[model samples]
Target: MNTKQMIKENNRLQDAMKPDNLSYYQDMVVYIRSSSVEESKGEELLLEIAQHLLDAQAKGKTAEEVFGSDPESYCKELVEQLPKMKGLNRLQYHLMIPWIALTWFFFVQALVGFITTWTGGPVERMTQVRISTLVLIAGGSYVLIHALMRWMKNDTFQPDEARRKINVRSMGIYMAITVLILIAGVWLGRLLPVLTIAPWVSLVLFLVGIAGTKFLFSSK
Candidate 1:
């Protein structure tokens, strides 16, 4: 559900509470009803939203009515005439895109590292740094994207997109792809005459690097 929907639903729930507490619910609903927008948001937009919600409760219809037959019209008027909806906020398409991209970027690079090392090329110490940086980026992306998804899509933490809502065959395919990558890496590593690093050692480093990066950049 969208923010507006959430606010509407929350409004309905809040109406059941004590009258003294209704002000807060209506205030929140006002902002969700807003269509004004903020190019950049700050306390100004927040306060404006707050005031509108309060007004809706004070002189406007109850929050439960946002879903009423007149709600569409009401919301339309609220958005258009309400003037101070939100400050200049631009519409964001999806927060998932960047996070998905970042995670895959690191996963691909890890493969590249394995391939290079397997081909008897020397892997640099900085390889971990590169991996770590990518992981950090992915972790941060995951946090924000997860937050956006939680607030808008569902209200809880979720794993990566692939990890969620997958069919058994799809899950199997994911595992197969992972195994293939590991096998290829191992094959390349074994092909080396002296193996600058052991295969298990490299794997351990990869795991440790990812874990450390996550811990360092953790948002939760």
Candidate 2:
């Protein structure tokens, strides 16, 4: 089955688990899914584990009895054994978020420029390319992805109430950090050299972003 189907099956199976076993099994689910293993393999393993746990439960066994007490260590071992994503696939995965974000950003800029030019706004001969803004976005996205992975790893061990609190706190911190990065990027952009971009350049950039996204994500 595909990743989505496996996940759906796992979810359906988990509904029958005893409370303690469900909690234990969910910890494994979170940790395994958070790892860098290929999605299909990860979900397949999760579904298989869910099936095994259900069978064990039917035999009057606990999840701890079946998989041992240390879910984290067991999950880590399983993740290590799973095949990692291929190089191109990994690249596409990492770039997907930032690529979509930047594309939409440039698209808005292009659309505004097109509208302004048609509406008799001043057409400038040059436009500023904020290198630092681009840098901040790319760097920030990488940091956020790693942060989320770490959060998932740690949060899996926490009680539900505590995990909810942590989620709220983490989101606040992330938003604060994003604001600071934007401020810093604006400052740094002023210190960098400006690029010469015509009034119509944003439109070109929008088209390029579309083409580049297709090329990068296209199947081999």
Candidate 3:
């Protein structure tokens, strides 16, 4: 199928599935990509898995039965079976790691800062930290947005203008969210007290949150 056709089919499949099932499939796709599978192959794998789910549902089976009780393990097995790509695809796959990490790092810091603010942490110290954190957040946001655009442009699976536009729009939404969070953090830092926890403890908490969120979203 052509790129537009493929995207249409993908959208149809996603719309047909239950929300939880769609989320499961989306998570699986993310996991597969993060596992170093090439983008085209990842999309092919997702389409195959999505079809299986639809067929199972038609047979009156739950998504759990279709995907198995342990979706994470199933996805890992799929990743293991994928043939490694060479050349630019391989390079792009490796590059995605640090890009994703930087994005997650900023996201975690923003979330943690918001938590600290809501808890009545001291405003003075937080305001001081916010300066540096904001700078890093802006840089991280730019890196993430740029990486996403580059990925979309280079993706072999969705080379059509339609798919590229869709992907860019999604990235724009994510950027908007990042901007809002940064703004909120700045305002909150000015209003709240400094956190009672030590810097190390807070750092630990941020790491934990980043790890958990990454696992859930990327599963890598």
Best by lDDT: 2
- 220 Cα displacement, candidate 3 (Å): 26
Where model 1 places Cα greater than 4 Å from the true spot, the runs are: 1-46, 59-61, 65-128, 132-136, 139-147, 150-220
Q: Model 1 over residues 1-220: C-alpha lDDT tens digits?
A: 4444444545555555447435434433443333333312322333344444555666655544433434335444445543442321221222234434554554555676778778877666414433334434544454444444334222111235633554444456556655655565556545544323344455565566566545543322
Question: Candidates' lDDT values, in order?
Answer: 0.45, 0.80, 0.62
| Candidate 2 structure lDDT | 0.80
Model 2 ranges off by over 4 Å: 15-20, 107-129, 158-187, 193-220
Candidate 1, position 172, lDDT: 68
Shift of residue 40 alpha carbon in model 1, Å: 4.6
TM-score of each: 0.27, 0.67, 0.43
Residue-level lDDT of model 2, residues 39-65, one tens digit each, is: 788888998899999999999999999
What is the Cα-based lDDT of residue 207 in candidate 3? 73
The local lDDT score (0 to 100) that residue 39 gets in candidate 1 is 18
Number of clashing pairs per prediction, in order: 13, 0, 6
Clashing pairs in 2: none
Runs of candidate 3 exceeding 4 Å displacement: 2-5, 92-220
Model 3 vs. true fold: TM: 0.43
